[model samples]
Target: MQKSLLIALIITVIGAVAIHQFGTALPAYAAFVLGAVLVAIALTVVSNQPSSASNAKYSGPTKTLYVGNLPYRVHENEVKALFAKFGPVNSVRLVRDRKTGRRKGFGFVEMSDTGADKALDKLNDYTFQERTLKVREARTQESSGDRD
Candidate 1:
């Protein structure tokens, strides 16, 4: 955008010089003003975009649990029930295969921060559904080119 603005400013200055030197039309001055305004607006927009590193901060729902060893038929409601005892659940999602639609043995659970911290402290290595469930604070995955 800076490069484009530099190119545009140069073009506008050249046009202004041409109009002052040899042209006789008012529209040339208007064209220069329009170009200048466009360049200013573009620069403002570019400066306003968030830096790529800014997304390092948490922005969405808090990760309450990184559930693993989930049974194939375990549904979202059941997962919610298991953790609802800790706190209000924000969401429960069962990771599934694209084609087979089978459980991926792991999923994410979101909850209020208060509940999340408690669950993290108490649920690690706890047994559920005959499997030793490992729970922890979930980490966000950077853009993988596949997501909502």
Candidate 2:
């Protein structure tokens, strides 16, 4: 645990003990002050806790494949099923338009390394639903700084 968090926990314990022993003996306003201090310590601890977004990036290598030329009416389950023929699929994410929420005709498929390689070789240019599929490794999008 972090040092600041440990210190805050120790302070909280001390405050709880003091309040329990002297709550009634001490003046009403004094008890409120102690309670406020404990609340502040709790808030500090919560704020210091790490956020999920901070750890969103996968640190290790991932076998994520970019799937293009998908039929607009294609479903995520269909994509998963198609790739599952190659290996155990981890996940499938279909791209969509932000405003209309319409399918973007492309998406990503996550699977085992061997599965990804097989899918790339076999699925690329493979016809499905009258469209030739474009299967390849998903490339990290280049960050575009401030748009405005």
Candidate 3:
């Protein structure tokens, strides 16, 4: 976003200098205004996109929970609805196989720390879709041996 703003400012300055030197015609002024508007719209939309790391933004302290034993049929919305009962769910990410794009029977959920604690207590070992769910605080994955 900062980068985008910087670029926009630079373009505006150059445009202003060109207009002042050339004695801007009506069409040139209109084009300048239209271009600025279009750029502003594009920048606003591009900057608002969610980051890949965490889709949801929590207002308070957040916790990420590891959810295991998910049914193959389960999905993000269902996980979110289930967790929403305990507290505001930040995000639900169901793991999928890279090649097959199939559910991996596990995922992660983010929420307020207090809400996450409640969810862990109540949902762990709870049966859902004929499978027992395993809910616990998520641990960072260890670095892979092959990765540089």
Question: Considering every candidate listed, which one attains the maximal TM-score?
Answer: 3
Please give the RMSD of candidate 1 to the true structure: 14.5
- On residues 77-147, what C-alpha lDDT tens digit does candidate 2 reach at each position? 89988988887677899999999999999999988788789889999999999999999898766533534
User: Which regions of candidate 2 fall more than 4 Å away from where they truly are?
Assistant: 1-61, 142-148
Clashing pairs in 2: none
Q: Candidate 1: which stretches are off by over 4 Å?
A: 1-61, 143-148
Q: Rate the local accuracy (lDDT) of all candidates.
A: 0.73, 0.81, 0.84
Per-residue alpha-carbon lDDT of candidate 3 for residues 76-129, written as tens digits (9 for 90 to 100): 989988998898788899999999999999999999899999999999999999
Per TM-score, what order, best first? 3, 2, 1
**Which residue pairs of candidate 1 clash?**
none
Candidate 1 per-residue C-alpha lDDT over 1-148 given as tens digits, one digit per residue, 9 for 90 to 100: 5787688789677766665556556566776786577667866797788865312333445655788877777888888877767767767888899999888988888886777878877777778777777787766566434576
Candidate 3 weakest ten by summed lDDT = 49-58
Q: Candidates 2 and 3: which is better by lDDT?
A: 3
lDDT of 1: 0.73
Q: What is the lDDT of residue 19 in candidate 1?
A: 59
- Tell me each candidate's TM-score: 0.52, 0.54, 0.58
